[model samples]
Target: MHILILGAAGMVGAKLLQRLARDGQLGGKTITKATLHDVVEPTAPEGCPFPVEAHASDFARPGEAERLIAGRPDVIFHLAAIVSGEAEADFEKGDRINLDGTRMLFDAIRRIEGYTPRVVFTSSIAVFGAPFPEAIGDEFFTTPLTSYGTQKAIGELLLADYTRRGFMDGVGIRLPTICVRPGRPNKAASGFFSNIIREPLNGQEAVLPVSEDVMHWHASPRSAVGFLIHAATIDGERIGPRRNLTMPGVAVTVAEQIEALRRVAGEGVVARIRREPDPTIQRIVAGWPRRFDAKRAEGLGFKAEAGFEEIIRIHIDDELGGRFVA
Candidate 1:
């Protein structure tokens, strides 16, 4: 199978690339070729059995999406986007990259004759806005309050409609805020979720821009990649017409998250978190859904870490060499 991965330079995208390179196959089929695309060139995985190509360009530009889709990959993983905070801050950029880019990709695929590739889109839980039920479910309506969320909501609708028209085989997974994200933080409004845990463990001070009482849904990077792989390979017929589903995740308050960090690491590590509230981030996060039922995704074989503590341990194992500075 030939695979194409957009946004392969980002954290989640990079991890997915590494996982695919290590396995050299998806589901059960050997990968004969792979292409990685991002605005900034992504690094090709080393020592791969098959050829790997990395391209850098603004895919939202006219003709760009068509060029990427010309190879007619069997499986397309679309993880590219302007993240939450960045999107909310720059409306036009968000609209162009998140909304127009996705549409262009779908249209490019449609233009091809007899090409129906499996498309796995990485959406966000941000698509669900506030006034949420105790647990947001698959049946709940999307009422996004942020530009980023709005973009993803539109993308989900497009994916379903395109799939219904038989233009492509699409699976959209709405991922939670992936906690303990490795490496330095980006502009995502949800970055603080990972920051408070990651920075403290590294003996660096992290600023908590929101209250301890604040709650949110979370998963580990490991689970995020697993969700994408399952979405790519699962029987699309079982998914039915509801092509987009929320991936399962753990729900916890900031206090609970700090405690989990303390349990996994130590008090000294926890001490590194200094409270310095930022109203902008607080306002943005306030509108996001804090919990999800995600029954549809769970029944569809999607899974995530059971709780915040396990998420911390996974970060240590995967990114911190299985240990931290106590």
Candidate 2:
């Protein structure tokens, strides 16, 4: 089996590549090739048993999507997108990359002759609008609040339609905000969520962009990678024509996250966090869903971190060598 990962340089994409390379197989078949594509060339994973190809290409650019799809990979992980903050800030770039790029990729796959790959698209919980119910269910209607959310919701619709037409087998996993992400903060509005814990653990000061009571959905990087792998391997027949499902994750408030930090790194480290609420972030977060029912994903065998404490532990072990307070 051949696997292709777009947005291969992003945090989730990079982690997924490592996971796939380590396994070297999917759906009981040995991986013959792994292709990683992004605007910038992705760093090739070390010790990959199969051939790994890293290419720099923009899917929205002319002929780029077709060229990348030429290999007819059995599994395509479309994890590429401009993040929430950046997308909300830059209208044109976001539309080009998030909305247009997705269409091009799906269209390219649809035109392929006798080729039907399993497209595991990484959607976001942002698909739910502001005025959300206490817990959003599988049947909840999509009413995106941000341009980024709108684009993701649009992508889900396209995936379902494409799958319905028998062009490809699509599984759109609406990911929760991945916490304890391994790396420096980017421009995402949700970056502060990880920063509060990540920075303090590293003995650095981090900002709190919203009130402590602000709640939201979360999952670990490990679980996010697991979702991609499972979506690729799971029986799509059970998924039926829906093609999109909200992934299960822990629901926690910012106060709970701080408590987890205090538990792990002690109160002193947690004290390093400074609170300077930004109303823009508050408004943006206000429209986001705080929790999800995610019954469909759970039934389909997807799992998430038990709690914020476990999430922090995963971060410390995976990225901090299980030691802090230096």
Candidate 3:
């Protein structure tokens, strides 16, 4: 099988690439080739059994999506997007890349006479706004409060409609805010969720932009990659016309997250967090969903960490080499 991963240089995308290179297969078929795409060149996984091609280009540019789709890869992982904060800050760039880029890719797939590849779109919890239920469910309607969420919501609709028209086998998974994200933080409004824990474990200070009581849904980087793998291989007929589902994750408050960090890495590490609230970030987080009843996705075999502590441990094992600063 041939695979294509958009946003291949991004955190999750890069991890997914490493995973595939290690496994060297998807859905029981051997991977023969892979094409990586991003605004900047992506680093292909080393020692892969298959040929990995990396391309640096704007897929949203006219004719660009078409050029990338010309390969007709068996599975396409669409992970590219301007994150929440950046999207909210730059409306034009967000709409161009997140919304227009998605549509162009879908249209390009339809133009192919006899191709209907599996398309796994990485949507977000941002798709649901405030006034949410105690736990947002699969049946809840999307009422996005931010430009980034609105853009993702639009992409979800397009994925379902295009799949209904038989243009592609689409699965849109609304991922939780990935916690303990590896490496330097980007512009995501949710970055602080990872930062407060990540930096502390590295013996560095981190800013706490929101109050400790602020609650949100979360998952580890490992689970995020697992969601993509299952979405790519799962039976589309089983997913039905909805075509989109909220992924499973742990729900915890900032206070609980800090407690979990203390449990895993000790009080000294947790002490590195310094609270200096930013109303802008707090307001953005205020409009996001806090928890989810993701039974629908769970039933389909999607899984996540049972608690925030487990999530933190997974990060320590995967990225910290199983140890942290005392």
On lDDT, the candidate that comes out on top is: 3
List the global CA lDDT of all models.
Answer: 0.92, 0.90, 0.93
lDDT per residue (tens digit) for residues 1-326 in model 1: 99999999998999998899899999999999999999999997677778988899999999998989888999999999998778988999999999999999999998887888999999988788879999997899989888988999999999999899999999999998888898896667788899999998888999999999999999999999999999999999999999999999999999999999998898999999999999999987888788999999999999999899999999999998898877
TM-score of 3: 0.97
Candidate 2 residues 1-326, lDDT tens each?
99899999988999998888888888789999988899899986889889988898778996788988898999999999988878988989999999999999999998887888999999998888868889998999999888999999999999999999988899999999999877897657788999988888888899998999999899999999999999999998999999899999999999999998788779888988999999999987787899999999999999999899999999999888888763
Q: Give the clash total for candidate 3.
A: 0
Candidate 1 vs. true structure, TM-score: 0.97
Q: Which stretches of candidate 3 lie over 4 Å from their true place?
A: none
Runs in model 1 deviating more than 4 A are none
User: What are the models' TM-scores?
Assistant: 0.97, 0.96, 0.97
- The global Cα lDDT (0 to 1) of model 2 is 0.90
Clash list (residue pairs), candidate 1: none
Q: Is candidate 1 or candidate 2 better by lDDT?
A: 1
- Could you report the Cα RMSD, in angstroms, for every candidate shown? 1.3, 1.3, 1.2
